[model samples]
Target: MINACLLNDDDTLKLVSVAAGSTLPTNTIWLDVNQPDDEERQWLEKLLIEDVPDEDEMDDIESSSRFRVGPDGVHILSLFPQRLANDTRGVNMSFTMRKNLLLSFREDDVSIVRLLRYYIRHGKANIRSALDILLSLQDLKVDQLSDMIEDAYSTLDETADTIIEEGHVEENLEELVRQEELNGQILQALYDSRRALRFIKKTFESSLDDRQNRNIDEMLNDIESILPHTQFLANKINFQLEATMGYTNHKQNKIIKIFSVAAVVFMPPTWIASLYGMNFKFMPELDWRFGYPLSICMMILSAGATYLFFRKKGWL
Candidate 1:
């Protein structure tokens, strides 16, 4: 769907829905194309006087494909965090800026866009230019990432406590790996945003005012702060993983030790039985009635001796 928001003469924002045949309002300042149909895409292309990239093009990771500067203006393809039912991740989004207009295309909704809308509707933002809106979106995206990191910190704390206090990670290897993967995703998203911001800062070096530059600098600082946080979480996860492996090794060793001690305890009995079973017609003990009783006594004594030896050596 195509959703357009126009800034009015009275400094208020008005939202408009642009359908297949609907005309784009002349005062439109921001146009959001969400999972646009072919007709809507064509309309946007015509309105913006530039070709709208397809989903595949938007997903490109190369610097050249991600950002471009032209006589008209700058085009940026960025990845923003999207929360899934079970996980949070980054999704590619396309933004085109020309003069006072900013157009965004995404296959799905993102919190950045939602937050932007909330600010505009509540008159809490003074969005004077397309770049202003972009900066505001970036600010909100950073906040979202920070919140995710805070949650990860809490989880890692709990995981560490479980291992220290309860003496177990209480999760299989797969579960631990999944958490690591999630942390990696959050780290990647932060990196992508940082790259995008730096590119923007460099591209329009002279156009930005002191306030805009400070805002961008503040954003960079925020991302810098978050980067270390993710690194800390990663280290903690690795520690937990190692702790899990150590516990597994301990348990396995205990089982092996039990079997080894059992074998040692049984050795003497097996040896006495084997010695008596030897078929020898000339053996006097074979005919003796007390032979079996004597053999049993020898086996008991040998077994007890072995057990005591192991206990003294602390190998029991």
Candidate 2:
């Protein structure tokens, strides 16, 4: 859907829905395009007098392709993590800023954009220009990212608690690994947000006035502060993974020790039986019934002696 938010003379926001083949109002200051159809896209392109990036262009990762400043405006494409009911994934969003107009393009609906619109309509935000709107959006994004990191920290704490209270990790190894993977994902997302904030600061630092520059600076600082917390959580998760692996190896070694001791205890009996079973007609002991009983007794005595030696040495 295409939405045009127009700033009125009374310092209020008026939103208009731009449908296919409909005329875009000339008074629009902010144009938001969400999953635009071909016709809608064409209409927006014609209205802006500049090219609008499609999904593929927005998804490009190259710095040159993602960020560019032309005579028309400054275009920036960034990735932001989107969280639904129980799932989280990244979304590509494109922004274009001209003299007094701002255009944002997204293939999926973003709650941030919706909240911005709601605040503007309800007179809760003191938005005067497209720049103010952009700053507001950035502030909202920073707040959300902070919340995400906080939630991840809480989850890590809970996992750590589970490990401590259980006193063992054998049954929950898989769960621990899964949680570690999740923390890794959250860390990456946090870094992505940090990069976006830095890019925005660099792009506008020279062009914006003092007030806007300070706002951007503050946003950058907020992001920088949160980075360490995410990194700490990632490290803690990795430590948990290593601890779990160590416990598993300990159990395996204990089993191997038992098998080794059993093999050593039976070795003597096997040697004695093998020597007596070697038959030769010249062997006088083989001809006597008493020799057979004596050989059996010797084999039992050897095995018992080996067992006693092992126990004495604490190998058992």
Candidate 3:
């Protein structure tokens, strides 16, 4: 789908749905192309007079390919955070910025885009140029990343409490693993955003006005502040993982210790019983009247002594 965002004379934003073969409005400031079909892609290519990056190209990780200057504009392929039902992941989105036009290409629906659109439609966003839209998206992305980091912090705190209390160690470990993955994605998104911002700053330093420069600086600072939290969370997650595993091992060893003590406690009684059960006709104990009671008493005494010995040695 292709949505064109146009700025009105009254400084309000209008969202237009550009169908295949339809000419984009001349006043459009931003063109958002999401999972375009073949016809839409053709229409976009025709409108922009250049080919859009495909899914594979957008997924490229090489810095040279991901960030570049071309005849079309400043091309940037950056990772954005996408929330799943149980976890978060990074989704790559391509951006091409011209002096008066900004185009975004993505295969997935990112919340940042939706939120930016909503803000624009509601007159909550102050967008003066295409570069402003790009900066606004980056700003919103940093806010979302901060929110995600806060959530990860809360989750880790709860997981730590669960681990320390020894409640559901297995479940907590699993949750920590998932949290680790989410934190990793957040870190990746932050790094990508920083790199993209730095590239834009360097490439457009001469063109950026005071406001845009300050915006970029603030975002860089925000990213710097949020980065340490991610590292702390990563370390905390690892520590919790190890702690959970140790707790599990301690519980398992306790169980094994009980079995070991029990086995040792019963060994003497078992041996005595086996000796008495031997069917030799010349066995002296069989001829004694009180032999059965004597053997039973001995078995009980032996078991008791073994148990007491264990207790005395503090191995129980």
In terms of lDDT, the poorest run of 10 residues in model 3 is 161-170
User: What is the Cα-based lDDT of residue 250 in candidate 2?
Assistant: 77
Q: Model 2, range 1-316, lDDT digits (tens) per residue?
A: 8888998888788988878777656667888889988888777777665777778888887778767887678787766667876456667888898878888999997888888889977889877788787778878877877887777667666666666444557545665565555556556655656666677678777667877777878887887887787678778878877776776677779899988877887787788788878876687888787997888888788878888998999877
Candidate 1 residue-wise lDDT, 1-316, digit = tens: 8878888888788777888767767778888889998888777767665678788888898888888886547889888888876577777889888877888999988878988888888888877767888888888888988988887777777676666444355653555676688788888878878888998899878788888899999999999989998888888889888987897788889999999998999899889889889998788988899998999999999999999999999997
Better of 1 and 2 by lDDT: 1
Using lDDT as the measure, name the better of candidate 1 and candidate 3.
3
TM-score order of candidates, best first?
Answer: 3, 1, 2
Alpha carbon lDDT at 284, candidate 3: 90
After superposition on all CA atoms, what RMSD does each candidate show versus the true structure?
Answer: 2.2, 3.6, 1.5
In Å, residue 149's CA in model 2 sits off its true spot by 2.1
Candidate 2's C-alpha runs over 4 A off are 14-16, 84-87, 115-126, 161-211, 282-308
* Ten-residue stretch with the least lDDT total in model 2: 164-173
Candidate No. with top TM-score: 3
Q: How accurate is candidate 3 locally (lDDT)?
A: 0.90
Query: What TM-score goes with each of the models?
Result: 0.92, 0.80, 0.95
**For candidate 3, lDDT tens digit of each residue in 16-69?**
888889767878899999999998887788756569789999988999998999
